[model samples]
Target: MALRMNVQARLDHRFAATYNRFMAAAERRWAYESRGQLLSGLTGRVLEVGAGTGVNIPHYKNADHVVLVEPWPAMRSQLHQKVARDARVATTVVDAVVEDLPFPGASFDAVVCTFVLCSVEDSYAALAEIQRVLRPGGTLAFLEHVRGGWLASRVQDLLTPVIRRFAAGCHPNRDTEGDIERAGFTVLQSETLKPLPVVPWFAPFVKGAASPADHP
Candidate 1:
């Protein structure tokens, strides 16, 4: 367990370093555009998973209450800075992972996940935890880059192992939309976005809304 934790810590450090270098560039060019619209719509008691460097902070205008869950110490450090600078919404940052959230069941009215599902240790378990914490009729909004076309998908598959070494276990080829469906959420709106012309390998995106299917 100690060895595993050490390895994970190294990977987390790498992810923080890499993201800190490129996050600004990506946001200015593409990420902000792809993610901002979805985040702007979030409201009520909102919980955001993998709040990397708090990229969604500026876009959360509608949320009255916000809780950010981020396990990596590096990311959490930056997230703290962002939260401190912004006081638009009451905010709390929790150092925790999605698979084992610290919040009580049925605690949140909405959850926001973006550029997150790709790196979780167990995507299914994370989604299950999201489901468990969300109030009945709660909303889940996500924006993720998923598996691309045939040629690009093969490249993603081949590169995933190497990427995981430094990218915090990100899987570029995950079928995130399908996983969301199987998690027993009724997808309210879903759209497949065209690939970015510059990086076809990281092409193919999905953004949409979903609610618990069994909500009463």
Candidate 2:
């Protein structure tokens, strides 16, 4: 059991690291402008989940401080390097997952999640945690890939099993926008964009912001 767990952990780390390197160029090609736009209006202390390679680090101008939560050690190592070299703002990198956050209720002014919900073990739980840690009327900004049209959706469903085995457990077909609404957040705004023409499985993206319906 221990050996299997260790091997899986290593595999997960290696896959995440490789994915970051592979996607770095694609992100530049397909998501450069949108990345900055997605993070345009954030303010106060913020929490960002799955800060892969700290790609969004350069785009964060409004936040006073950013607390990055990344569970994968390999990604966190790269994140640390980026944070060290970044002199623009304050950043704290924590080795933690989104489903279970280590902050108090109403601790953050906003939460940011980009291209991360598809891989979380429990998307609902992660959103609940995001809701809990945010201040009343705080923002939840996200940019995620969702299920596409019928043909694309079918392809996503077919490839999900094999993709999960090697692609850091990412689900190609997820109704992430609906999941966000169902998590008791009032959808403020949302827009869909197309990914690169070749990767149909990763096409049909959504970028939006939401706020919790109420706070206790």
Candidate 3:
């Protein structure tokens, strides 16, 4: 079991190192636009969880300061490189997981998550942390691929085991929207889309903003 865990960690490291290259085509096709829309108008101190390779860095136009949280070493290395190259936004990279964020309560003005909640060990725990760190009336912006139609959902379920091993723990059929709502966030605006025509199983993408139900 220990040996198997080590091998899985090694595979995850490799996936982190090459994640940007694997998603480059998809980013150009539709992800960039979707990310820009999700992050638009966000300002003040912002926190982005699971900021893989800093793909959303260039789209941040109004943020005063950005904190990027990535737990994986290889992914953080690439994220640091991206931050170094981009001077448009003031940014800091922190090594932390979503479930256990090392920050004070109500520390950030806005929190962002892009393709993150799907892969977390505990989605509810992660969301709780996100809510704890966000100030009153603060926004939570997200872009996630979620469970789709009947056939697509079955395909996601069948492939998740293999995909989770090699794709850095991604579960393509998560009901992330429902998870967010259940975590006390009131959906402000949301849109669902089938971004990848070739990848039917990757459909039903959800992008939107929400605020804490009690605060809002």
Candidate 4:
């Protein structure tokens, strides 16, 4: 079990090193635009959970300060390099996971999550933490690839085991949108899109904003 854990950690670190390169084409095609749309107009203190490699850094134009959280050491290394070069927004990098955000309740006015929910050890718990840290009436802006259609979902299910091993814990078959609703966030605006045409299993991405149901 120790050996297995070590191997998995190495795999995760390798994935982190190449993550940005792997997603560059997808970012150019649609991800950048989607991020801009979802993250635009954000203000006050903002927290971005599972902020892999800081891809959303440039899009945070209107935010007063941005706190980025990434669990993997390699990913945080890359994220730090990007944050160092970016002067648009005041930023801080934290080594943490979404399911266990180390902060006080109602601390942030907005929370951003992109391409993260599908991989968390417990999506519901992560969402609960996200809700806990958000101020009343705070927004949760997210963009994620979720479970696809019947056939695609089945394919995703079949591939998930292998995919998770190599893709840094990503589960392609997760019903993330439904999970969000079940987590008590009222969907304000959502759109389903096919961002990566070549990756059929990664189709049907969901981008949207939500607020805590109790707050609204």
Candidate 4: deviation at residue 29, Å? 0.8
What lDDT would each prediction earn against the true structure?
Answer: 0.86, 0.86, 0.90, 0.90
Worst 10 residues of 2 by lDDT: 24-33
Candidate 2, residue 112: Cα displacement in angstroms equals 0.5
lDDT of 3 by residue, 1-216 (tens): 999999999999898878888888888999988898888689999999999889999878899999999998888888899998873779999999989999999999999999999889889999999999999999999999898788989999998888889988988888899999999999999998776565855668999999989899
Please give the RMSD of candidate 3 to the true structure. 1.1
Q: Can you tell me which runs of candidate 3 are displaced by over 4 Å?
A: none
- Could you estimate the TM-score for every candidate? 0.91, 0.93, 0.96, 0.96
Count: clashes, candidate 2? 0
- All candidates: CA RMSD in angstroms? 2.1, 1.9, 1.1, 1.1
Pairs in steric clash, model 4: none
Tell me the deviation in Å of residue 193 in model 1: 2.2
What digit string (tens of lDDT, one per residue) describes model 1 on residues 18-97? Answer: 78576676677777877878888778999999998888888888889999999888889999999999747999999999
* Model 1 clashing residue pairs (backbone): none
lDDT of 2 by residue, 115-176 (tens): 89998878999999999999999999999988889999999999999877677888989989
Q: Give lDDT tens digits, candidate 4, residues 172-203.
A: 99999899999999989999987536486676
Model 4: weakest 10-residue lDDT segment is: 194-203
Candidate 2 error regions (>4 Å)? 1-7
Q: Runs in model 4 with CA error above 4 Å?
A: 196-198
